[model samples]
Target: MKNFDIVTLTVNPSLDKSTSFRGLVPEQKIQCKNPRFDAGGGGINVSKAIARLGGESLCVFTSGGDTGKQLEALVQKEGIETHAIAVKNATRENLIALDLNTNSQYRFGFSGETLSEPEQQQILEAVSGLKTKYLVASGSLTQGMPPEFYQRIAAIAKASGIKFIADTSGEALQKTLETGVYLLKPNVGELAKLVGVEKIHADEADDAARTLIDKGQAEIVVVSLGPQGAVLVTKDITEFVPAPNVPKKSTVGAGDSMVGGMVWALSEGKPLQEVIRWGVACGSAATMNEGTQLFKADDARRLFEWLGRK
Candidate 1:
């Protein structure tokens, strides 16, 4: 296997198909445009975002059936190197449709195929055998899979001295924290859940993130505040950067783009402040595109430059 500075894992991947229609009338036969297909999931989107930034990472995912084959083809089209593990069940598909009249986007997602016990073990074996500086595990666990799956991977990464970064929510995210990670990217709501709070206001974002860091759950906690921007918290550093206003588009891959930007920056030896800025820049830039498309390199660069002056 070839070596890479960053490695991303997507246990439950999807083939995302997007289209637009004139209006959303009840039970009407709405005429829709041709659908756009993209290989989507947390880790895969991260790899694609890294590629958009002129960087490379090994994308490891599960592949099965015709949908899986098509997903692999789409990832190849993006020019990302991948290591796909075959499975018995087909990969899931998701739909995203835009209502032109209301400018609203509706997303429909299906449950992923459950992984067999043996298949689950294969995933662990693959992660244990990898050689990389960063191991990023993202997305939701499939049906019937243990919530501690990511935590197990975190343990493997720890034993191998690989920096683990996780982007997930709910029980899976909670379990992974038990094993600890190098970094965690959680939205405001998810962060609130982690710290046992009902909500985390903007003024309390830093302390909320610090609660996790203080418990040794993570070395760095980056709380994404959406339009308000993001906050990066560590034991010694707490920097809050406001988001730059931009035109609205689809937000399908914004969070993954942020993770991709931060990991790429960390790999390049950038400072923590600049790393958070790059993350916010890429995330904001991702919303400038339609459907499941990530940010353009030019837009990200422009946003990064603008953010530097703030």
Candidate 2:
């Protein structure tokens, strides 16, 4: 088997199971066929996108009981190498139902069983010993974790000379930013939450983006504005990357795909501008698929050009 130099850590992971039916009726017991299951969570999705792009990465997270084993088998089947810490409770399972005739999808999510302190510590030790060049820590914070975990992880990454990219929401996002993250991917809601601003419209990107940078919280911020595209902010400059007009799929894994593409491009020494292009491309491409199946590099590149990449 080949080796990987990038590692993504997930605090909370799950198995995403989806079923499709011709019609989704209201208040009726409807059965669906063409059901599918996949490994999921923000970091796991990032790893998934990386694998599809012909890159390698190790997905690290907590799993336990039957669900954990199933998740491992599923991920390995998809060719993603993993390093996981087993816990007591069963891993979570998220479900999805798609109505093909209506071209609509519905999803239901569940949180994974929480990890104990020792389990959390063990994962931290594993993270401390990981030899990857890029440590992508993305997703929700486990319940019971200290608020400073992101900050500590950032310090560890700095000490180890690893590029740390964080994608989290709410208070976790704010806490992570306080750690001087190398890069952060925050949607408008997340950005708004961190800034204590409830509304983040297109006109608010400049001020919001600048405020995060000026606070010495994040070095680079990618403010995802959904269909309107995204805003990229550095200490001194901000760039806008518009989304491609593609037939919508399900809007799943778009952010994770963007992070995967960004980290991949940057790892190859691509300029930040080009990296942002690839990130935007991947995110846009992901919106072209349903459930968790994200964009591949080639398809995303084609969409990139159509989106007016210059």
Candidate 3:
């Protein structure tokens, strides 16, 4: 509801190239039967998910080399507004593991080069132009960036009086929370880390979620519980929303799409609980598709209605 729409930032973006193989055999030269590569990284995926839901998100990210050009085209081809910061190094690529018979897959990501001093400044400059009320910064920070890089972003958004929605893990996530993130989407593993709990059982994850809010790290904490669904904890309300049973080709990108849907719904000023409901639906729908692609708006909408009934 401002001069500009949503803006997303990806410090260390990537181009994900995945291959479909018949089977994985260790210690031998194996050729994938089929392979495909697409624009990747959390921010990129978020923007794409937003677009799929008929919303626009300005995607600002760093890229370099031929891969950068390719990524730029890929992002733009989806009709997303893009602001690319050129870097000296090339972009990073990830390998995807797929099992043909079982139709299961695993993905391994490689960390790209760290942004140089000037490159970092360019990002700060971009930060100055955001007019949107919501700014979502997701994914891991590239190495060589100060450990508190995400913290600095959170501070910037907070200082500007903007809402910051963070989705990340490890030190970057922890550091950003200290800067006062508006909301956080953490899976079971991440929530466990935030609360210093070793194993997060389904029954106790809600209590742990409350502890995160109590710690003042995040105003809203949503602990995603895969098939069992997600538990949303706010300062005054905590609800467990069960995801409808959907046929999942793969679980990749389901969480990211959930975050995107939540942000989009909130951007429209929908009610809090409804936003959580939409998020749960989107996450489950993304699982219904194979590969890293997010859920289609139709599927997401259908799932939302289906879940709303109960």
Candidate closest to the true structure, highest lDDT: 1
Candidate 2 residue pairs in backbone clash: none
- Per-residue lDDT of model 2, residues 1-310, tens digit only: 3445788998788888877888777899887786678888888989888887778899998888888898888888878898888888888888887788988888888755667888878878888887778889888766767767777788788888887888877666677777777788888877787888778888688678788788887778888888888878887777888877788877778889999988887777877777777788999888887777778668887866765535
Query: Per-model C-alpha lDDT, please?
Result: 0.94, 0.81, 0.84
C-alpha lDDT of candidate 1 relative to the true structure: 0.94
- Best candidate according to TM-score: 1
Superposition-based RMSD of candidate 3 using all C-alpha atoms, in angstroms: 1.8
Candidate 1 vs 3: which has more TM-score: 1
lDDT of candidate 1 at residue 217, scale 0 to 100: 98
Better-scoring candidate (lDDT), 1 or 2: 1
Worst 10 residues of 2 by lDDT: 301-310
Q: Write the per-residue lDDT of candidate 3 for residues 1-310, one digit (tens) a residue.
A: 2354677888888887776767677898877756566787888888888888888888889999999898899899989889899999998887776777678787888888978999998898888667778888877788888868888888888889888888888988888888778889998988888888788988888788888788887888888987899988887988889989888776777878898888888888888788889899888888887676678889999988888889
User: How many residue pairs clash in all the candidates, one count each?
Assistant: 0, 0, 0
lDDT of 1 by residue, 13-88 (tens): 9999999999888887999999999999999999998998889999999999999999999998989999999999
Q: In the order shown, what is each candidate's alpha-carbon RMSD?
A: 0.7, 2.1, 1.8
Candidate 2 wrong stretches, greater than 4 Å: 1-4, 308-310
| TM-score for candidate 2, residues paired by index | 0.92
Shift in Å, residue 115, candidate 2: 0.7
